[model samples]
Target: MRRPVPVFLPALLLALTVLGIVTVRLVVYEFGGPTARRKAVTVPPVDGVRITSMTVYSGRLPPCPEPAFDDYGHHDDPVIRPLPTGGPGISATYELHNEDTEVFTYTIRFMFLAGTIQVGAFTDEVVRSVRPGATVRGTVRPETQDPYTCPVTRVKVAEVTKVPDSELPPPPERCPPSGLRLTSDHTAAMGLRVVGLHLQNCGTDDYTLDGYPLLELLDTDRSPVDGARITHGSGGVSGISLPGSGFDEPAHPLVLKPGESAVSELAWRTDTPIVPYLRVRTQPDAAPVTLTLRLDLGTTGTLAVSPWKLPP
Candidate 1:
């Protein structure tokens, strides 16, 4: 045989060449080589901002209020009234800033933890670019729920930047503590005239009074009134100049602290005739639990059964 001419020599050479090429590529890439530099685009860091203030308005139920729309259809900051009664309608305002170079979108929402659980959400227009030192204002309208112990209701930021998850600080606390009474005449056009008691300084440091007291009429036995139109008196705290329905409005929204007591009045008239006293219950947002008033009509316009009177 022409002597396999040491085939190992050729094989060795090929292996050496391959190793050299790989080594060169590794060294080049390790030090900012053109091939490595032309790879994927760089993503800058993203920054976020928190909301400074939020407000809720007062109103009735069913169709709640919405944030005002600008001529361009963009939403504007809302002016909320305190302690909106009836149903769930809240107006929230937020101030935010983005230190990142990219555009971001923010979502605002509310969470009701106690009594009932619900998430109230609203969206803001896309933010094209929040420069390293720029600020933006936003607003959201959240639906309210039926009267219940919404003591832990709060506003939060649900989203920011391109990130799918984000949250904000908890909202201030509100303790709606008040008393109410109801009287029924069964003969007036206005079936029920309601009066309220605003317990002053009955809330925590975080919240203030938003609206007058609230009163609800429940059957002696427990049944929800689906369609009830109750009116309140125009009178303030001094003395009730009660409405025809006899329901007077509290002069100021009651702010009760941890252990404080206040008295209020409410009245209503029903078409159904009864012989025994009616059960009048007061349901507030927070403390002072629920108080029930059992009134015995002594054939005249006066209270026969009150907490002061004990049954013998």
Candidate 2:
């Protein structure tokens, strides 16, 4: 019995030694393994740059001309252009002076408000190089609902690296009017007259559209309507998303392939005066398409526009 006790004691000691070695190896692997090595690596902080001054232009800015009416229609009502409500497509520009010593790219975000409610946001990037001590400008056009008031609330530096001398991408080729077609359909619901603008790409190449189409009301003689103010979107109404439509999101560039079609919504009041014709320009410089559809814009001269969306 005494001899067996000695043998058993030696076996017990050997098992305990192996257990301790295994536990130590596990502890070291957990504390100094790949995860620990990853934690040790750190990214250097980006030095903050300064924006010396920011000037916001509230009303209709340049590149967008004021309403011009040609004398063609007879009417007793005084024609007044729609008042400016800054949002996605509303023409507003921001002038920013970079105070930093280094060149950087920036993005400007606008907040549209109706009293305390935040109705919409318009964001745009400045693609041109903004050298230190230089002034660069960007435009804010709400592609969605036109809020009653829009103010520049935030500026973020999207990238802090050096901007290339030729940073601007080549401008896209304009789509010819022959390759595209515009048609409209209207429906009356809930006291609002909604007109759907259907744009079809019949050309060989794809066509892209950004922001709202340039809209002008023309009389029977193809002359512009006087005092007709065209405002974009349901005035001051938010959360209007055209379901299953790309325009339901923020205003961004949309591309239509050959044989593909996209739709946009134009909404006005029901009791408004009727315009005999509508002229739409897809791009700023593209040829205008004269539409003969009868449009009723309410008394406010405001029009609500939805983003361009693919039909379901």
Which numbered prediction scores highest in lDDT against the true structure? 2
Q: Distance (Å) between predicted and true CA of 206, model 2? A: 1.6
On TM-score, the leading prediction is: 2
Tens-digit lDDT track of model 1 for 164-185: 1111111225323332111232
Candidate 2's residue-wise lDDT over 1-312, tens digit each? 111244585577578767873221100112111110001112222223333222222322222222444587444443433333322232334456666666655434344333344445534344455787886655544556322233322333322323222222122254444577677887877766677888888789888988777888776444778866665544543334345433345666889999898888877655556675677778888766655456676334656677676777
Model 1, residue 227: what's the lDDT?
42
Model 1 misplaced stretches (Cα beyond 4 Å) = 1-47, 56-89, 103-116, 119-128, 143-152, 163-312
What C-alpha lDDT values do all the predictions have? Answer: 0.35, 0.52
Cα displacement (Å) at residue 122, model 1 = 6.1
Residue 139, model 1: Cα distance from true site in angstroms: 2.1
TM-score of each: 0.23, 0.39
Question: What are the per-model C-alpha RMSD values against the true structure?
Answer: 25.2, 27.2
Compute the lDDT of residue 11 as modeled in candidate 1. Answer: 76
